[model samples]
Target: MASNIPKFRFLTAAQVRRLHGTLIANAQPTQPALLESAVQSPLNIKYYNNEQNLFQLAASLPEKIMKNHAYQDGNKRTALVAADMFLKINGYKLQETPLQTGNVSQDLENAHVAVCTNAWTAEELGRFYEQSAKAIEEWTPEILAYRNEATEY
Candidate 1:
């Protein structure tokens, strides 16, 4: 059965670059090859005629982007933000708090290793995404308020 949820807007390479510029100091401009892959990744997922589900798309996004090295620097950061935005637009959010623990960089590094080494299969990654995220409707007012405040700054 198809989900009742509306399809979310996936990020374009330009939007990803804009996000990187906004968030990272001295961010490197996106290369053409990088931009192409970054733009194509989600479209490929969206249009795939296979058995992949939405969770798989969401799970594959970060891994693909991070592994592609779509940016000269901060590829992992860009990947994380892009994945989060994708999930948020789709009414979900990553539950891990690597940022709160000041381990985002480390987390990304581990994610890279896992992706490259096939430590987690695509289905497994999808399960991991499911495990790490929850519906936006479940967010507490305090968490929502904090998210709002954080976005504002």
Candidate 2:
């Protein structure tokens, strides 16, 4: 079945640079190769022309960004933020409680280590995204407003 989620607009290299600059303190500048990979990862997914679902797309994005080492530092942080933004744009969100946030952090660290050690497959990372995120049935007015505002810029 087709996913209910909307198609995603991948972050541009300029946008990634802006996000990194804004989010990281004294951040190391992004390399051209890293920026290209960051933009390409989602574009590849967007045109995969396969039967992949939205959760799979959401999950793969962070994994691709993180594993590709898209920044001199803060790859994990960037991956998480990019994935979250992708999900939000597609009408989903990661529903994390305080406890879940801790778990997610630990999971992210483990995933990083696994990727570094060549012990994790992209499929595994995609599964993690699917497990952590859920489709939103009803958005609160506040959340809707926030999403609207976020997309406006």
Error of 2 at 86 (Å): 1.3
For all candidates, the clash counts are 0, 0
The TM-score values for the models, in the order shown, are 0.68, 0.68
lDDT of 1: 0.61
User: Please, what are the lDDT tens digits per residue for candidate 2 over residues 1-153?
Assistant: 976645444555555555566655457545668666765665676576453466666666667667677678877766666666566656766644211356666776676467556687656766766777777777666345435543221
C-alpha RMSD in Å of predicted model 2 compared with the true structure: 4.8
RMSD of each: 6.1, 4.8
C-alpha lDDT of all candidate models, in order: 0.61, 0.61
TM-score of candidate 2 relative to the true fold: 0.68
Relative to the true structure, candidate 1 reaches a TM of 0.68
37-136: candidate 1 lDDT, tens digit per residue: 7656666766664434667776676777777776777776666666666666566776444323345445544654576577866567667667666777
Model 1 CA lDDT for position 84: 64
Clashes of 1: 0
